[model samples]
Target: MALDFYTNPMSRGQIVRWMLEESGLPYEEKIVAYGPEMKGENYRQINPMGKVPAIVHEGRIVTECAAICVYLAEMAQEADLAPHPDERADYYRWIFFAAGPVEAAVTTRAMGFSPQPDQEVMAGFGNYDLTMSVLEGALSGRDYLCGARFTAADVYVGSQVDWGLTFGTIPSRPAFDTYAARLRDRPAYKRAKARDQALIEAQNQAQGPQN
Candidate 1:
C-alpha cells in the first residue's frame, strides 16, 4: 500500500514532500487548501492541529514535520538516510535543534515578531542573529550534520537552509550556501521542488486578482 501524504504547496508541507521523494517511498499526494475549512471536520481527523504535512501509513496517522520525516526514514531503511544506532544521539539532537530554535527564529523573522528586551528570557528563539550564528557554528566544519556523509538530518536541516535562502529569512553564508546547494543538486529535491513550484503557480493563476 502506498503512503498517503497530506500537504499544501505553500507551507511547510513542502519539506515532507521532499522527504517522501528522498525516501523512495511511493506516496499518494493530497493537496489541502489553506483555510478554516481545512481545519474543520475533515482535516482534524487526520491532525487535530489542522496542520499540513501529516501522513497516513498502515492505518496510523503521523503528524508534526520532524516526526513524519523520521518515520519515513525508518520505514525506508534501505535508503539508509537516517543515522546509525550509534549516531542516533546526534541525529535526534540536531533534528530537534533545527525544529526547535532554528525554526522558531526563522518563523519569528518571517512574521516580523521580535522579542522585546524584557521578554528575551522568555523567548524560545532568543534572536535571529544568535540562532543563525549557532547554526553556522554547527555546520561550519562538517560537510554534513553528522560529519562527511549525508544523513536524514541533512534532509530536515537542508530544507530549512533551502527555504531560508529562498525567502531571504536566513543569511546566505558560505556554509549555508554550500550545504543547501549540495542538497538542491539531488534529483529527488529537484523533482519535488519543481512540482511544488508548478502547483503554486497554478494556484495563483486560479485565484487571479480579487477586489
Candidate 2:
C-alpha cells in the first residue's frame, strides 16, 4: 500500500513527518500550501477538511496529528513505536490526554481566553493551570509516558510539550525542558525538523526579502 502524506512544511504536518520517519515508511510527500491549493477541489477530495497533515494508507484516509501518529505506530510493528501490551492503558490515556486537554488548554491560553471557575466545569481541560499541572505530573519522574518506554504516545504528547515550551504557549518548567530535550535527541525528530527547515528556507528564498 502506498502511503501518501499531504502536508505543508510549516503546519502540524511536522508531527506526522516525524512519525513517518520513525515508522521507516517510504511515503510520497505532497506539499499543500495554504489558501487556494489546500482548499482546491483536488486536495479537498483527499481530505474534506482541507487541511495539511493528512495521510492515505491502505486506501484509507487518516487525518489529525494524533490519529496519524497512533496509526503509524500500529502499522510499523517492526519499529515497535506502539506501546507494549502492558502499557496500553497509559498509552491511550496520555495520547488522548495530549490530543484533548493539553491541546485545548494550550490553544485556549494562547488565544488569551481561559475558562472561569464556573466555566471550567464545561471545559474539558478544566483550566490551563490544572492541565499544565497534570501534564507535568505525567512526565515528571518517568523517562517516557509508559514508564521508561517510548511509544507513539510520546510523539503526540511530546510534541505538545516540545512546542509549548518553544512557542511560550505553555509555561516553561524544568520538567518540560528536560522532557522536550529528551525527544529532541531522537534521530527521527531531528530528521523531520531538518527536512521541514530546508523546505522553509527554500520557500523563503523563493519569496525573496519580505517587507
Candidate 3:
C-alpha cells in the first residue's frame, strides 16, 4: 500500500499537505472529518490520540506536525529540503523552537491566558513578550531558520510564524513578515493551502447552526 495520510483539512493537516506537495510525492489522502466514525474507535488504532494529521508510511506511523514535516522532507530526498549535515544542528534548533516555545506561547495567548509575573516561568511558554523576543532574535539576521537556504525547517517554522501572525497570536514584525511572505510565495504552499481552505470553509458551512 502507498503512504496514507490521515487528515482533516481544517486542522494542522494543511502543514503536512504543503510539505507533501513540495516533495512532489504521490500519497493517498484520507480525509477524516470531526464527529465522524473516522474519529472514533477504528481510527484510534493508527493513532491513540485520534488526531487528524497522522501518516502511515512504510508501515510506520508518524504524528505531530513538526515530526511529520521533517520525516516527509527527509523521505523525499529528491526535493532536497533537508538541511546539509553541517547545518543539521541549526535545523533541529529552530524547528523544535517553533514547535515548543512558539507554539505554546501562541496557543496560550489565543486561549486568553494572562500570565502573572511570578507565574511566567512556570508556564510552558514563559511569557508572550519573551517568546516573541526569542523568535525575533533568531530571525533577526537570518533569511531562513537555518539561514540563506530554505529547508524543511522553514516549512515548519514558517507555518507557525504565518499562522500565528494571521490569528494575532504573535506580532507581525519585520522578521516574521518577511519570512512568511517568502513561504507564501512557494507554489506548493499556495496549491496545498487552496485545497485545505476550501475544505475548511465547507466544514464550517456544514457545521453552521440552523433555525
Candidate 4:
C-alpha cells in the first residue's frame, strides 16, 4: 500500500508526477539530485540505469516514465486510468508506440543525431519526420489516443506531445496542438506541473543567479 517515488523536478519525472496525481495515489517523493547523487551506488541499486522517475511500489521497483505510468494506472483501477477491456488493442499499441517511436524520435532529434535515409530500417523510429507523421495521423480525429475517452495511454503519449511542443522537438501540428490542449486541461496535469515547477523554482533560487 506504500509507494516511493524517486525523481528530479527538472527531469522526465514530471511525466510520472502527472500520472501519480491522475491515479490519486499518495506516494513519498524522494528528490534525487543529478550527477553523483543520481549515480551513487545507493541509488544505482534502486535503478540500474541510475535515472530518476523510478517508483518502488509495495517493494516492486518500476522505472522508465512510460512503464511507471501504465503500472500506476493498473494499481489505481478505481481511477479508471487503465485501459478498458474494449480499448485494449488501441491502448497497448499506441502507448508502446509513444514509448518507442515517439520517444526515440524526439530524443534523437534533440541530441542532433539524425538517422541517414539508408539507416532508417535500422532505426526503431526510422526518421523524425516519419515518426511524427505517424503520430499525427493517430491523433488527427481523436480527443485521446484510444479515442474520445481518456486513458493511461494519453498520459504517456500526451506528455510526449506536450514536452515536444514546449522544447521544439516535436512539430506543432494542428493535431498535436489539439491533443495537448485537451490533456493540459486536466486538473491532475495542472497539479503535477505546478508542483514540479515550484520545486524547480526553489532549486533555482537556492542556486542563486547563474551566468
Candidate 5:
C-alpha cells in the first residue's frame, strides 16, 4: 500500500509534508481538521496522541514530525536525504536534539514559563539560553546540521528554525537566518509551502471571513 499521511496543513505536519516532497515519493494525504476530527476514533487508531502528523506505511505507523522525516528519508535512500551509516551519528544527534531539548525549551518559553536555576538541572533542556546557545554553536559555521551536506536532519531542524524564527519562539540569530535561507532555496520546500498554502486558503474560504 502507498503511504498514508495524516496531517493538518496549519500544523507541524507541514514539516513532514516537506520531507515527503523531498523524498519524491507518492503519498495519500488525509487532512484531519484541528478539533473533533483530529480526536476522532478513526484517526486516534493511527496515533493515540491524536496528533496532526502521523503516517502509516507498510502496515506500520509512525508519529512525531522528526521521526516521520527520518523514516521517509531512510525509506527513499535513492533521494540521498539520509546520511551513510558511518555518518549517521550527527544525523540522529541533531534530529533528536531538535525534537527534545530545542522543542522543550522553545515550548516552555512560548508558554511563558522559565525554570529556576535549581530547576534547570531537572529540565531536559537545561534552560532556554543554554539550549539556544548549543544550537547556535552547532550551526555557527555549518551549512547543514550534519555538516556540509544536507540530510534528513536538516529537514527537521530546519523546520524548527524556520517556524521558530517566524513565530518569535526562537530568537533570531545569524546562523538561523543563513540556515533558513538555504532551506528555502530547495525546490521541494517551495513545493510543499505552496501546496500547504493552497490548503490553508481553501480552508479559510470555507470557514468564511471573521469580524
Candidate 6:
C-alpha cells in the first residue's frame, strides 16, 4: 500500500510533509481540513486524538510530527536521514528533546504561562529560559543535531527552531538564527514550504476574505 499521509497545510503536518520530501518516497496525501472534518469519525478512527499529521504505512499507523519524521527516515535507510545504531544516541536525544522540552517550553510561553520556581519540579521543561538555553548550547557550534551529518533528528529539531523563531515563541539567539538559516537552505524544506503555501492560499480563497 502507498503511504497515506493525513494532514492539513495550516497545521503541524507541514513538518511531516517536509520529512516526507526529504525521504524521497512517494506518499498519498489526504488533506484533512480543520474543525469538524478532522474531528469526524473517519479521521478519528485513524487518530483518536483527532489530529492531523498521521501516517499509514504498510498497514501500520504512526502519529505525532517527530514520530512520523523518525519513522519515514528509518523506512528510507539508504537516504541517510537516520543515524546508524551506534550513533543514534544523539539522534534520539535531540529528537525527543525538541518534541518534549522545546515543545513544552514554547507552548507554555506562547500561551503566556510561566511556571513558578517552586513549580519547576512539576514542569517537564523546568522553565522556558532553561529549555532555550540548553537548546542554544546544543546547536551553538554544531552544523546539525548529530554533528556533521544532517539526520532525521535535524528535521524534527530544525522545524522547532524554524517555527519558534518565525513566531517569536523562542528567543532570537545567534545560534538559532544560524541553524534555522541552514535548515531553510535544504531543497526539501523549500519544496515543502512552496507546496504548503499554495495549499494555504487556496484554502483561504475558498473561505473568502473576512468581513
Q: What CA root-mean-square deviation does each model show from the true structure?
A: 1.7, 0.9, 1.9, 0.9, 0.9, 0.9
User: What tens digits encode model 1's per-residue C-alpha lDDT throughout 123-157?
Assistant: 87788888899999888987888888778888888
Give a tens-digit lDDT track for model 5, residues 89-137. 9899899999999999999999999899999989978999999999999
- TM, every model: 0.93, 0.98, 0.92, 0.98, 0.97, 0.98
Candidate 3 lDDT, tens digit per residue, 141-188?
A: 888888798888988888888888887877979988988998999999
Stronger candidate by TM-score (3 vs 5): 5
Please give the CA lDDT of all the candidate structures: 0.88, 0.91, 0.88, 0.92, 0.92, 0.91
Q: Give the least accurate 10-residue stretch of model 5, judged by summed lDDT.
A: 82-91
Kindly report which residue pairs in candidate 3 clash with one another.
none
Scanning candidate 1 in windows of ten residues, the lowest lDDT window is: 117-126
Clashes of each: 0, 0, 0, 0, 0, 0
> Candidate 6 lDDT, tens digit per residue, 75-173?
997788988777699899989999898999888888889899999888978999999999999898889888888998888999988998898888899
Clashes of 5: 0
Instruction: Tell me the lDDT of candidate 3.
Output: 0.88
Off by over 4 Å in 4: none
Error of 3 at 204 (Å): 5.1
Per residue, candidate 2 scores C-alpha lDDT tens digits across 1-211 of 6999999999999989999998998999999999999999999999998898899997999999999999999899999999888999999999999988998998888888989999988898899889999998998988999999888988889988888888898788888888899999999999999999999999999999999
Clash count, candidate 2: 0
Residue 135 error for model 1, in Å? 0.3
- Evaluation by TM-score, superior candidate among 1 and 2: 2
